[model samples]
Target chain A: MSETPASSVPRRVRDASEAEILDRLLPRYAAARGAEVGPGDDAAVMIQLGDRYVVTTDMMIHGPDFRWAWHTPFELGWKAAVTNLADVYAMGARPTGLVIALAATADTELTALEELADGLTAACARLAPGCAVVGGDLSVSDTFTIAITAFGDLEDRAPVLRSGARVGDVIALAGDAGRAAHGLDLLFAEGVDAAGVPNADATAALRAREPELVAAQLTPNPPIPAGIDAALAGATSMMDVSDGLALDASRIARASSVALDLDTAAFAAEPNLERALRGGEDHALLATFPATSTLPEPFRAIGVVRAGAGVLRDGAPLTGKLGWDPYTAWDGQLG
Target chain B: MSETPASSVPRRVRDASEAEILDRLLPRYAAARGAEVGPGDDAAVMIQLGDRYVVTTDMMIHGPDFRWAWHTPFELGWKAAVTNLADVYAMGARPTGLVIALAATADTELTALEELADGLTAACARLAPGCAVVGGDLSVSDTFTIAITAFGDLEDRAPVLRSGARVGDVIALAGDAGRAAHGLDLLFAEGVDAAGVPNADATAALRAREPELVAAQLTPNPPIPAGIDAALAGATSMMDVSDGLALDASRIARASSVALDLDTAAFAAEPNLERALRGGEDHALLATFPATSTLPEPFRAIGVVRAGAGVLRDGAPLTGKLGWDPYTAWDGQLG
Candidate 1:
């Protein structure tokens, strides 16, 4: 995945003991701000802020979840962290700690794993200051898997939930709508072969041509701070727009028993309107606020909440597929 | 691994959508006791008991960490939950919540996953009362993996660390030491063919003959409650004896800058003294208490701390392999 030639990778995971690999990887992570006992213990201890805390987990696997040839280990780590952090932020909480469980093949390059640790550290420092990896586990497996569980401090604020949306509220989204999905389309169309095989040379060329789109797909920097802002701004309801705008909005609508009526004109700046509606993995924050509340920074109004069910585009029922489904969408293809 | 007939499992995971599978599985988990916002939200919010919490993570992969041919889905889930819970218990905290990330092949049976959820719930209810699965993610992968992150409430008590052991302290152990490892050996010797293929009939026969050993290996019930008892009784140091007595004792010795002088005479009651000293995965609690302190129920004195470095057996340095290492020990054989 990395451009660092395979020849330069000095050792594989199998060549070293688990302790040796951990000695190299663990130092790259910064200690959590609230940590009392960090990485060396059987469990990490952290000081809590309020009487409540938020927790979420997600997993990224090789083959079905990703194509190893199309992503650097650093990007994989960053994306994994971003996705989980987005869930915690959706609850109107500030990210504080992360614990990773990684399973990889014996032949995996040790340097790649180190780079992954670096990316995790960098993302925590940049997106959520004071948050860091608190603990982790390593194991050997045929299919590479990275599972991260992120914790957040509520800061004494009540968590915002998808079921809190009220009728006649303003619908807003923070961060790009379809950029990551559009990047996926570009990668498959321009960088992959007819048989769905990834060509590294073609991918590099595409990266050069569309750095923003490619970066969006690879290392997404979700609007983490906007979650706390929306909560403080009196958000009625909130969620992470993970499985496409239409699908995720529908979830909110179903949960709140309301309808989200969207205006495509608000998305006129996007390169593809359809992708904005149907594409997935953008990791944006979708929130609804009272009509009297002022919209927070980075959030732009795209629609309004009505007394109905499901999502509507320009006042019509959304047609075609809603979003990605791992079970039905994965076609046994891998890079 | 279950005795249920294969034909009884009527549906595969691929036959249903991810939402459909979630709809069936999510309800099986009980809400955490402190949950303000449980599953169905982007993240779960739990009210903290004190100003601090302990967190730990562990992963079980299909091949190196577990054998599909040797364990039922229920056992796998129980083992996964127990393993993580033991880590929290070792820190002298009460487990409050768990978030699981499960990845399995599309061809996996839907019933198997449901049984896994049931196992997780049963373990939480029985071992760590009030603790439950608060959130989880499901994905498709070629190799089945279960990654669980457990959170524990400190109850405003200080966490017990491995580095607190002092010279002249009493080294104590609660629960069986070598039974799980012995079960693994029995399975490999009697229930598997020379080519490393599992024979279900042989496995069933062996399970019936040695139920306790097999149960120890499959669904271990670690001394979870004793962790709090040890802490309340003024334990100097504690950890889960997961990687053999000699090896884990050596870790405490190195961390505390003292030697653990174990008496094999104390292990004479065990069926296999050698396995008790060198085997792994029993999930026993190992703690050190002051010489003047009374030992807690279920905890028995096994040795004493001395002014030296590393583990000593009857005044001699321990010899032979310490314990299991996934990287160096796996022989590329799967049943």
Candidate 2:
């Protein structure tokens, strides 16, 4: 929280050498069950249960993907890991292990880094049991950055790709949405700073007022279980709503060469429909299934696939920007 | 050369959108043979050739791992790829695929990124025939950094680890050494700058003065083939001379719990023993074999595994540091 320091106790990284940092941190990250040989070796040998592995990597840097004022080091590590794990789950694979690269300036505190390791390991245990942080690299850089590459095993289930959706299919959504965008709004309105946020108990006060919203921005909980459930229920196409529902739905449409038409009336009763439909980083699973198939729980039908491209609302083509595009969107500028 | 600029024509990344950058550069990097499904998806699906897979990652930040004045973007990409590949090879596995995470400031030219992608593809084509750049994430950062995760297939062969060495074994090394360290010296002596080197083209003029040394630093050609050779020839223990020979050798000694007594006279005939002995980033494979076995080409016996621990020069304990220890070595301070 902005009211608290990145670490409960301050300890600069320069106070200890790289060796001491590794020694203090490596033990904090638990080993994965799938790793035949774990960290400390030249390379990690992770056992395979299938013929192919699903791999994805995501990077979080101080200036672009996130701002230090909005999140703690532990939150940074947790959020970064979850983003990649969501991608792996979106492919319908069971998460296996992750390799992390942390680069920070000499001024960074060792306690902050250790907290980051704790968050990473803790997140892995909660979201993807049996999966662990297998290996990592530490380096000094002018800006703080975290790069995580997560892998998963398919386990006989065919990967559900973005290109597999078909016309005449039922489009469905799982997991919550829009809270992160609202959380970002709260952060913007508060104008937090490095000097620290007033004397308010940031996390506790935010929790009492907008706990879910703030948490959505700080700690995104990806629908890890729902992805596999959708795959098992014969979902033809799937992708996580990392970049917002409208944009991600459009992605599925473009990839599958079909059209997705959403009904605004279906969500009119809900508050903040625009944010629900267009807010990014919800980490929800958007999927399509055969119209006749019984849909899975938490996955409610919101649209129908049609013989066209792009996304439509109220039977009309949506105009203007629908969601975040790092290059084109204003939110993409400096995170 | 710095005079030519990072791009033949200026094209700042900030001038274009993220989509435009990907459109301009993704095609430059080739796909690998192992990918069942490649980039542009929720996750990459790569087929495994064996029961287990070799995975390792390394990061290079501009200020620490390299200097902008000394190496071009292409060279940075190449050197970074080789460094990661060396870890895979050290595990006695054939390189398969790589995932890269690149972060740079918005002011960087798109052409520079393209050159980096080209270098990644070129390095793959050269050192790893079947390997390819699978997927990646691009972000904005104040300092330029590249995080590469490379994986490999070991087939049915047993992995040669750093803890397998035993007493009465012949210690050997394959690949060139010390040139990179001296190359660092050349860069330091030349004092290259942001405005570009005066009169002399950095790469060309430096090559004319010390081609091997300069090349060693800018574009190190790691001994990719010798790793498998050592494994096939029954290497008891193995690792690459990445940090430095003395430092890495001591690592094997510590891991295997055996002393390595080196004969400096064996390398005395070689020019510049300091570079060969203490210089790092050589990417050369070092291994220990049974004393009775014949050594392979490019691999020469230079020491003996003994009852004690740590590295020794001749009969007595060697004083002063021989190679880099990231934690204890001064080189680890900023970098």
- Per DockQ, the best of the predicted structures is 1
Candidate 1: stretches off by over 4 Å: A1-10, B1-10
DockQ of 1: 0.88
Q: What DockQ results do all the predictions give, each relative to the true complex? A: 0.88, 0.68
> Residue by residue across A1-335, what tens digits does model 1's lDDT show?
33344464348877778888889999999988988888878899989988899999999998777777789999998899999899989999999999999997877988899999998998888788889999999988888899999999999999999998999899999999999999998988887866768777788999999999999998999786799999999998999988899999999999999999988999999888999987888899999999889999999999999989999988998888988887788876663
lDDT of each: 0.89, 0.82
TM-score per candidate, chains pooled = 0.97, 0.93
lDDT of 1 at B162: 92
Clashing pairs in 2: A19-B327, B178-B275
lDDT of 2 by residue, A1-335 (tens): 12334554436665566667888888998879999888888898889988888889899887667776667788888898889889998999999999998887767878789889988987888889889888888887778889999999988789999998888899998877677777876766553534444223454455568777888888988666688889899999999888888989998999999988887776665579998889888888999999997888788888888989999986788766778865545343343
What is the lDDT, from 0 to 100, of the residue A331 in candidate 1? 73
**Candidate 2, TM-score vs. the true structure?**
0.93
- lDDT (tens digit, per residue) of candidate 2 on B1-335: 13344544447765666667778877997879999888788888889878888889899986678776677789989998999989998988889899999887767888789998988889989999879888888777778889999998887688899999999999998887787888877876564544433223564576688877888888989776788888888999988888888878888999999888888887877678877788898898889999887887789888999989898888567667777644344343232
Choose the strongest candidate by lDDT.
1
